[model samples]
Target: MPDCSRPNRINIDLGPYKQRWVAYCALHQLTPSAAFRQVVAKLTENMATAGDAAAAPPTTRKHRKEIGLTDAELRFVEACAEAEGFSPTRWIIALIQARMGNGAQFGQFELAALGKSNLILLTIARQLRQIAGMQQGLAGGPMPELLPVVAEVRTRIANHTAEVAQAIARNIERWHGK
Candidate 1:
């Protein structure tokens, strides 16, 4: 019998769009794998961009304004950079990038929230698994010899869940207050 695990690569006949893809890949200096990865990255990076061209948000063609910052605001920006262990200028640029929708800040926030909730549930599930493993280990079985390690992982996961929940709650409260 043939191995069923590997994916089959088939040559798809692209009637007209084949040239376009080739040209795009050539222009971007990408190999086949790199081109595919780039296309996927771009689509994943901007979900809105994957929509109909006419329905996409209007692009801002004008140059961005360089507004003067107050000393207090500058200090706050610097403090935030310090706290995050990033350069103040790069942090400001990242903020601008996020505002311009060049980066996935909104998507990241949604994913982080979802991950935090899932992590909490995963922690409890892992704990249960560890308890099961411990029971098996107590029965003189070698399969569950790593019960102590699993328990430690469960403890770390539980702590992480609490921290994530607290942060999420604080964000929600602050958002509602605004």
Candidate 2:
């Protein structure tokens, strides 16, 4: 085999444990070069340990209390949680975190966006109905000439709905990653 020993000419500072290092090498049946390699391996392992320590999850404390809710409201909360695929407690925790402006919270932004998008769709639908009525008045005919306008409005609604769906997908993906 090729030489596995490290060069002894290299200078190293053993600090206060220099004598202990010599004894440890003798006890472990290691040459000076092998002892140095072992020390380096230990140091590398400790560096990895420090990195793991830094990445450790933050601590959390939970305090629970009983809160009275009307039966109807409790049922509604449960229903909402079921629809969202979350436990009622987790859903409530998400809500509280959202209200507290915690970035780690889930669903709040997407929920708000979905609500707003639905409202916009409703408004667009209402406008289309109003325009159809106006076209009927203008043309004074059985079938209003507003068919094209109605078609255009329908297309816009579809586009808006698709956009909202895409946004929801993205939000869901982000939540899953979290």
Candidate 3:
């Protein structure tokens, strides 16, 4: 008889998609086993969220799974999650959900804020370019007319630069492992 303590291995036949699946795994730098596990995990997570009766059992903890982690890795996860005001399990779930889905690791608000920052920077650059063109096309010692625009751009760049840095730091802290 087979040992019950050991995990059972199963073979999957991908048929025509076998090459495509292998290529995807290679591109993502994941082994076939890891990719398969992720796909199954994501499917189960979705089913659980959808309240599929067959996918969930009464005796089982719906949201818990024992992912093998070394002692040091577990400690690191705990520490990182604690710093981010989440339990290690919650952190891991969030990471997996974000990384596995077609979404960015950043929260919606965080992504929006970053997008707004990029737009502001682009506008500032355009304003500066316009001012430079005006200066170059016409001979002028100083353009007092554009001083207000320059000042505004300088202020915005300074403010938005700081905000972008903070956002980047927060995102890196939240998704460091990913």
Candidate 4:
């Protein structure tokens, strides 16, 4: 029992809802205090009637709330997803995860591109290593012929790396509409 003399010792009977509240908290992986904080923030937001929506900073979306979209909006989403070479559902999920800062947000096409780039880099690295080994195995010193080949391979690596970086930047900018 709480001490009634204490000013902050307010209580509310949960009755049958206590179990449900506990389940809700468990489902969301939040402690009671954390859940209550979200509830309080939402309550305050609802009570405030004069706040400008545009002036408010964007909040992290931490819950699943159903949003209604018109046909036009759905089409727009589909078009945007198609432009990025992704399905609408994948695009939406990727967007949400990106907003949450979960990790890299790469579309299917972007991923394939990166994968190809990685494979090329690996092949180039192997060739460079082989050339280095050959140069080292030589009796006297570095071979002039192998030197030009090594230089060319290094240039290829640098150019390919730059291209991959640019592609990643473009994809990120497209994804975030920046």
Candidate 5:
């Protein structure tokens, strides 16, 4: 084969480790370049042990993305996509799909929740799996860095729920004149 070990080429040169890396990339749906870039980025951040990196500052997102479109701008995008034989919505979705990183599958998150809550929970579980995959690509595993953030988010949600429940209870008491 050609000299694939040059940069920007997918060359599996490390025997069993190469095979395992290929398998992992396939499983996680990550392009080797993207995966390698993530690792490089992590290394740039800090070269401490896994425990030390996990305890370091919170891992920030790769980048900030925002979509802003006025009606005229949206119409223009629609017109362009339509001229290219796709609807504006589909064009936007295609762009997003192409830009998205590879996803990972995690365990079944089936909880005995009412109505569509299970669906939301399951979606969360899947997204968390993807996040873990990204984190792994960056810095191995055991994401202690995310623990505090997750806990704070959970606590905030619980407090908000409690406040809403208390408000509803008070309203019910007023309605019943009790």
Candidate 6:
């Protein structure tokens, strides 16, 4: 995610072309704010995720690009962010980042949000076998006591992960500007 240290404010006056583009976006059922976000998402969709923040050096901030939004539009964004426990700035960043898929790489955020939890679920089978081996050590044969609980948790997480992935897929399709 970009350094969203402040709220993204479009304080500059739009040139004529920009004015027309904004109007066209409104004609397409997208608000000016949503259009700006869509444009940004398209621009950055293929960019790689940045280096780890812990390993990155801090630097002076550069001027950020701004867009023009009406007071009502800005207020709506603020309200949505607040409802989601995010500052308006973070919410804007999230909007852009959500649109930027992981491309070919699986970053932490992508893994968590996508079905990479499947990887964790995959391990449960082997883990159950290991637990069964331990039980064999305690007795003389395989013990399946923990299997049911482990399987139940695995199924639940898988179902939840699928639900989240489906929701994200629908959102992307809706916002991808078909």
lDDT of each: 0.64, 0.70, 0.77, 0.78, 0.57, 0.63
Best by TM-score: 4
lDDT of 1 by residue, 41-140 (tens): 6766666566666356777785665768899998988886665445777567656665555642222344466677687677767777777766765755
RMSD values, in order shown: 15.3, 17.1, 14.6, 12.4, 23.1, 20.1
TM-score for candidate 2: 0.32
Give the C-alpha miss distance for residue 141 in model 3, angstroms.
Answer: 1.0
Residues 26-102, candidate 6: write the lDDT tens digits. 78999887888888778665552553553445556855878788999999888866654567776666666566752
Q: In terms of TM-score, how similar is model 3 to the real structure?
A: 0.42
- Give the number of the best model, judged by lDDT: 4
Tens-digit lDDT track of model 5 for 74-153: 99878756654456665555445444521211111111222235454565576577656657767565676677656654
Error of 1 at 39 (Å): 17
Candidate 5: list runs displaced more than 4 Å: 1-139
CA RMSD (A), model 1: 15.3
| TM-score for each predicted model, relative to the true structure | 0.36, 0.32, 0.42, 0.54, 0.25, 0.36
Give the per-residue lDDT digits (tens) of candidate 3, residues 59-125: 5456556779999999998886776556777677778866765232555556578789879979988
Model 1 regions more than 4 Å off: 1-49, 52-65, 102-146, 160-178
Clashes of 2: 0
Between candidates 5 and 6, which one is better according to TM-score?
6
Candidate 6, after superposition: displacement of residue 151 in Å?
Answer: 3.6
